[model samples]
Target: MEASKVIHAIYTDDDVLMSAVKTVKAEKYHIEDVFTPFPVHGLDKAMGLAPTRLAITAFLYGAVGLAVATVMMNYIMIQDWPQDIGGKPSFSFLENMPAFVPIMFELTVFFSAHLMVITFYMRSKIWPFKKAENPDPRTTDDHFLMEIAVHNNEESLTNLLKDTGAVEINIVNKDEDAH
Candidate 1:
């Protein structure tokens, strides 16, 4: 595959990075990616990314967990082997739902949390034993990096990034499959 040329702009502060993103966007330059040591609030918005649907998926997973808990409890308590506890011979699922509330709640939380984590990893193309996609290790400590594709505007883009307070800028050839 042919390699693509891109500009990497490194920033020291998140505030500078945020304004740089806005300025770059205003200049109609498409940003390929941004890497930060920690989550920067409003960075996604500054990059014009769409809202995430993880919350909806979490809700659906919780619903599924609740349904599974209900079905399992019903089969164990009412269908397979009925039990009379405290002299109450109740076999109805609704009648025993109060006691099942704790189990249902716990399963709901468990499913949502675990499934959301898996979904996030999958969506982000992150996998166990996969090579790191980060271009610079300093971003993992205290730097921010913004990648912009080069399309014969290298000179202007470099000038813009420098004007936006980029501490360092590098032009690199990146393989399309590297990500």
Candidate 2:
């Protein structure tokens, strides 16, 4: 409730870990999280993680950027800063829009890129000026870990994990030193 509550069981082999994940999922045991050094094929299906919608978000953000750029450019160059130096009509959207394209494209790319990066950081809880909380360093390198929080009893959970080919298991107290 107050902090991250998890117990990590590390596995050396990806094949063993994937099979264990499939078994736990089949048994309806809720896995808190799984970390792997490299991507494991079909692991997302086994973990029941739905496909991400980042592409949709990117498209929507890009559209918003485009609209904003178009509106701003139309108002500014057509109304406020009309230039008559090129011997062309000052307020013609069709004529001067070719000249306004660089600004529009720059604004679109800027807005979409900034917004998408912000969205990704917020969703993943990774941002500048914030420290990351990675449990096992080996899991970031060459190991895979599966975590489950056992509420009242742990005997059956431990038995199940052991039977599923967990190479090493340990209880991790997340709040012991975290402030």
Candidate 3:
């Protein structure tokens, strides 16, 4: 099985962390992980992460929700159980569409919010009662963490980590557990 070796370094400030990230990329070292308490702008560029596609998914889901709402309302209110809700006309779907607009709009909003939330949760691999993979509690609170796996130069890597202003460092034998 393939294994991942990690060096976890904690930094006190974001500036130091960003500088270290740039320096590491310049040196051609692969950075495996970074955890920050809050988002630091330009961090994704420094780490070379691709732009997320969640917004596109959200828009598609919204359109699906709107379409479902419009179709269901038309079938139920206009065809299945026709009612003389207003005195305009009874048998015409187009004539009665204005009255169903409120319901369609409401269902659109409802489905969009509910389905989008579920999609986000599933796409992110977050689920109810799932255990978190927080390695250190302080990583969520204040400290910024950088995890790098080196193929060689353990001594030089340690020296480079110190030069990057890492306050604490530890070797972590990351488990290669199957997802």
Candidate 4:
């Protein structure tokens, strides 16, 4: 990979980071990434990132789970072994649906939550034993870090970050950091 210089701006407060993101974006500077201790509302919008489709995927997964539960219940209760419980031998799925509601709901929630987590991990390249991509360890605690590439405008970008309430700014040499 080609070496590139980047500026890392650290912010103590989320609000400061938010405003700094907007200001830097308004100046036509491309922000490569941002790391925060907690998720900042609307940070993706400020960074001009595309809206996530994870919700849609979750819904789809939930639907699949519901369907699986329905089919499984039908096969178990109505088709495979219809038991004469409480003297009611009705082998209809609809008739036994009330008993299946809890299962359906549980499976739906389970699939949505578990599958969404897996999808998020896969999409984010997060896997077992994977190294963290966070540039600054402080960002995992009480700081926010914004990384912007330097395109022969380090001085102007540094000055802008200072004006935008950056607590500290560091110029990172990507090649040196790789080692």
Best by lDDT: 4
lDDT of 4 by residue, 43-110 (tens): 99999999999999999999999999999989988999999899877499888889889999999999
Candidate 2: deviation at residue 49, Å?
1.5
Q: Whole-model lDDT, candidate 1?
A: 0.93
Structural similarity to truth (TM-score) of each candidate: 0.94, 0.86, 0.88, 0.88
What CA RMSD would you report for each candidate? 1.7, 2.4, 2.2, 1.9
lDDT by residue for model 3 (47-122), tens: 9988977777767777887799878877887778877655655577687778778877777777777877888899
Q: In model 2, what are the clashing residue pairs, if there are any?
A: none
Clashing pairs in 1: none
Q: Is candidate 3 or candidate 4 better by lDDT?
A: 4
* TM-score-superior candidate, 1 or 3: 1
The superposed Cα distance between candidate 2 and the true structure at residue 142, in angstroms, equals: 0.3
CA shift at 63, candidate 2, in angstroms?
1.3
Clashes of each: 0, 0, 0, 0
Off by over 4 Å in 4: none
Candidate 1, 1-179: lDDT as tens digits: 56889999999999999999999999999999999999999999999999999999999999988988999989988999998999865589888889999999999998988898899999988998978888999999999999999989989999999999999999998985465
* Candidate 1, position 70, lDDT: 90
